[model samples]
Target: MAKAIGRGRGPTIIDVARVAGVSKMTVSRVINNEAGVRDGTRKAVLAAIRTLNYEPNIAARTLVTAGEARVGVVYSNPSAAFMSDFLIGVFEEAAAKGVRLTLVKGEDGLAPPEAELRRMAQGVDGVVLAPPLGELPAIRQVLSDAHLPTAVVAVGQPTGEGISVRIDDWQASHDMARHLLSLGHRRIGFIAGNPDQSSSALRLEGCRAAVDATPGAELIIAQGAFSYTSGLRAAEWLLDEACPPTAIFASNDDMAAAAVSVAHRRHLDVPRDLTVVGFDDTTVATTLWPPLTTIRQPVRQMAATALELLMGAIRNGAPAAGDHLLSHALVERQSTAPPNRARAPAPALS
Candidate 1:
């Protein structure tokens, strides 16, 4: 009998494989009673299991090996609040399914190098790609070549090659813009998110469509990188203009918070002199002096749904290709109100 190593937690499938002198896959096959193992190898694996006292969970037997099924999550987003919520959902589902997660951080919203991606593919059975990183064509091609199950979260549209989990960004933005219009905000400042993300363009288009449909409505666009600093700069630019907007709509909560800060610096009271709103409805939205009125994108739910899709594909031994559109809601709060008529910008000269 092989000596069992002492682990502080408990005996794992890896320990069983080590004692049996076989691969982890072989141990998994034995545990699940799958065919293709020689009688001698099977007996050796069973003996090792008995010696180590290993217990396999249902997820382990039905899906891939519990300890061996590695799923990679790649992200390069700059928003801490959004990432915090997303990671929570992922970890919860992964723990429940008895799966291991391998996190890979990309640089400046770009995917890792081809060589690094290839190396990662060898270790992971599937991958979950967060926004901006999933929009890259090279990254998609590389993963497709590897034949790994993949799930992309928060993209504007489904890529059709992998599982996509997201809210309808265009419609959500459109609804938010319409809400502002209904509040009598004719001239609204629009702060866009990162250009590299497909959601940015779709969101901008949605806001534009809403503005164009309403008579006398005008939109002043400013670029943002989905960071607090970028939001500050954009808000300052919009507020310093000859005819400043009465209301400002930022693509995310961080930018919206910056707009509120700029309003305060100018001695403007929120929803009195300036109406501000944002999207994503992250924690920052409510932590401000006046809670923000914005769109709830369900970030945590989207992450969990993506992980579930990836795991299902891994179990079925096929690529997961479908779009899962989650529901979004317009959350009303104290930050948005009817634009103060006295503070409205002067009409442009004909």
Candidate 2:
């Protein structure tokens, strides 16, 4: 019922500046992530914003600055656990950087509508693509064609020209295979991911290299769609074979956990007649009673580094310097052991 001018419907930076006793420009600088704002000034502006619950008009600011303070994050992964964890990491960093993050949800996270993806970048300053399969062919065209900056996170290989954040997946997977081989597991089995995925190929390469390196280790292979039930189906097929592998490595925790279920149904004692392992230290690994052995991917670090790198490129128009690769560690748990001598040798399959 009062006038609309003084105590308006929404709070503004002018009110925040008035509360902080600073110029509107100073408030703008602090909100826009300018480097010149002193720590004291920044603190005061932030306090004023909090006190007033002031929200900036991002659309209006973009019109003035000619760009949006948003960084797009593109992710492609089937596991809900993986997606959620990675997003949490990304959002945490974005909040610290004062950049609004825009997510362009591609169809089922597949590479499509490169043009639309690029247009999605029209207002935003930069982007980060997560993982091997996340970088669809369309992604490259959009970023390259527009000369927009980008950072690829958790990618196995450097994109050759842009900033990237990742771990040595080959080394991590190779180490997991070694863990099984060290446990005196000779006849191991593999549940591979979809052939279309590059991570699937790299991960398998790691398994092959590890087994081939061992003096007397053997592996039988089966392919699946990277789903838990897919892992179950493949594990069921391999476990029923006359020569069941003593140990199995699923490309991810989802599948590896499935293998555990299959083993339990067959009344085979885990780590006795059968053993299982998974990559990516996801929550699924710990959901099992005995847990799983896997590689602890630096998910949070990767996401943060990607944000840092993308911010760098957005400000500089060129990719950031040096390597952004992180390291991985093997998380050993109760799911593996040497083959049980009492168990029947794999019977020859018909």
Q: Score each candidate by Cα lDDT.
A: 0.83, 0.73
Residue-level lDDT of model 2, residues 122-226, one tens digit each, is 545567787644446567776655445667776655657567777776778889888888888888899998676666777888988999988878889998767
Residue 115: error of model 2 in Å? Answer: 5.3
TM-score computed on alpha carbons, candidate 1:
0.80
**Candidate 2 to truth, TM:** 0.76
Off by over 4 Å in 1: 1-68, 344-350
RMSD of each: 8.8, 10.4
For residues 14-43, write the lDDT of model 1, one tens digit per residue. 567557654445567777886667777789
lDDT, candidate 1, equals 0.83
What TM-score would each prediction reach against the true structure?
A: 0.80, 0.76
What 10-residue stretch in candidate 2 is worst by lDDT? 59-68
The candidate maximizing TM-score is 1
